[model samples]
Target: MIPFLSAWPPSPANPTLPADELHVWVASLNRSQTQLNQFWQHLSEDERARANRFYFDHDREHYIVARGLLRQLLGNYLQLPAHLIAFAYGEHGKPELAAEQATSGVRFNISHAQGVALLAFSRNREVGVDIEQVRPLDDGEQIAERFFSENEVAVFTAVPPEQKPQAFFNCWTRKEAFIKVIGEGLSCPLDSFDVTLKPGEPADLLQVKGSREAAARWRLENLEPANGYAGAVIAEGREWQLRTWQWPA
Candidate 1:
């Protein structure tokens, strides 16, 4: 099992990013006004403007904190001041470090929900991370049938009623992590791939529809960010080791 360590590094220096290691961080988005103000300093003007576009105050605060923390974390890895980090957007609105800033080939992805965020980092490999709070959905099964692959729908249908929520999120998070890894967003057909959703089972991308080779090229794993949350992370290759860390540790 992956362990989210509570130990903070002693120094503010750049952390090593090994080619064969993937780092995942769990962060709490809730912060006091003073702390939130400090995090705000890490944002770019564009990011700050985007934060302001959120409809809810809580959402706006969370976006600010999440973006700020992302910059801070990338700065640590990139050995630059947080404010100096630059980001560029992909065609699908996915964010990546500006070309010059990413010479080391460091790639990352972020996902957050309900005041918690998951950030993933890797060197020279694509990575995606997703976290969602486990909540009851009235149309959970219908959603499964509509989006999950045929095999996934069958498995999800067989899950006990009390366990459906967990199974639904397991499938959702894994599928989302895959899309993020590919940077294709919703245009990637959900039913075109398959992922394991049963609780207590190992998370895996069992098939990628037509390409067995594509399915073998990536690795997927389950994440338990917090008590009421379900998460998953996928990376380009199966060789890297995963390390989990807690923010503000």
Candidate 2:
């Protein structure tokens, strides 16, 4: 039911949506040399350096493609050259455009797992997006017991055996996205909040400790980026509508 991004390679489409809408773009890093070069040319010098730091060539290329496309899309929205976009990191290492150079309260977050990446943008609200490849978990229950809130652990244990892998990632991505939205990274304990994980349940933030009312303030929307991966977006305000797209490589 999500609308994939209609834009293609070389040029990105400028997204125009209502004030309360959140736009999400997903892309695959499996690109040809030509596409890789296109993304690399748009990246800042620092981004290029970061790309080179990865130990594996595959990892290096993923970094380059992820960042290059990020800058390209941001530039399209801001009407600036992609390489010129400057970034500032939050206290917990979340990257954001430098306040002085950013306009219209434009904000974005990116997450890539395996070969897939998801990026989400919102005008004024804090936003976080995460994508994870659903894979086998050798000690799923043990991990859940250690990190999940008591109620979340209860829910996790209740799911039937066949659904554990998807359920585990569903919970993980939801928690990660919320932490990113709050700009707290690992500083915000994962067990402090609750998220829904059962297969048929809606993707949602169910509760928040200390800040008991926060669960209602943030909204979680489920995403299916590819066949075996799961993705989600968490935005501070519940009023926002979500539009998903498949960004061109």
Candidate 3:
């Protein structure tokens, strides 16, 4: 069975969530075949098909483990068995529950970079999360200038050379989280808004098309899921207390 780190059998009797809290679960996707097989037992047929579509064995294994973990968590949250959980996709391929489960008030978003995965959950509010492995990038600056907003580009340009790699991912992950929160995916223009990208700077949305109020409505928090990897979480409200945990190895 996939194991949670601790305290994860959330009390169903007291399922009412605090209005000001969010939970982020960080886990590694790399799993042994035996573990992978156990996870696969919880998957829906459609998910299995998608997993089978991956050409590489590792890619397929990762997909199964990721979806399996997702189902397991949702099951715990909803007090249901893992395979009983159902998912429906949004217009932009964002996954949601069937209309029957809409009243549960559990909002979540997922992102995986390389082998690390992040899952963000909240009650009655939109949430987004992203994780990315840090690696050498020859065209990091060029890509930033082309995609990041003007103000964001300025911030990226001002960062010292040695710190650019981390700063670039900082900006990229924040943008990705926001877009996922909005459920627009990449259909929304990356350059339409700005986000904090410099090292040592507080994580913030900065500005969304110069609307300070719009910017203020969102919150960004840096995530350190593992060394050599960067993560971020953005949501539609402010001052939401964050609680994060990792899956058992």
Off by over 4 Å in 2: 1-12, 210-212
**Per-residue lDDT over 1-249 for candidate 3, one digit per residue giving the tens place of the 0 to 100 score:** 233335432323323346688888877799888989989999999889999999999789888988898888777778888899888889999988777666788788888877778888887788989888777699987898799998888888888988888899999999999899989988889999888888878888988877878989888998877777778998878878987777766
The 0-to-1 C-alpha lDDT of every candidate, in the order given, reads 0.88, 0.84, 0.83
| Clashing residue pairs, backbone N/CA/C < 3 A, model 1 | none
lDDT of 2 by residue, 1-249 (tens): 223334312223566645688988888887888988988998877788888889999899888888988898788777789888899998889998897666658889999988888989888888999999889799989999988889889988989889999999999899989889999888888999989988768998988885658688888998887777888899987888887778654
Off by over 4 Å in 1: 1-14
Q: Which stretches of candidate 3 lie over 4 Å from their true place?
A: 1-17
Instruction: State how far residue 233 of model 3 sits from its true place (Å).
Output: 0.5
Q: Tens digit of lDDT per residue, candidate 1, span 1-249?
A: 123333422333446889999998888888889879988999988888998899999999999888888988988898889999988888998888897987878899999988888999999999999998889899998898899999999999999999999999999999999999999888899999999999999999988976878899999989987777899999998999988777763
Candidates by TM-score, descending order: 1, 2, 3
Candidate 3, TM-score vs. the true structure? 0.92
Worst 10 residues of 3 by lDDT: 7-16
Error of 1 at 239 (Å): 0.6
User: Which is superior by TM-score, 2 or 3?
Assistant: 2
TM-scores of the candidates in the order shown: 0.94, 0.92, 0.92
The TM-score between candidate 1 and the true structure equals 0.94
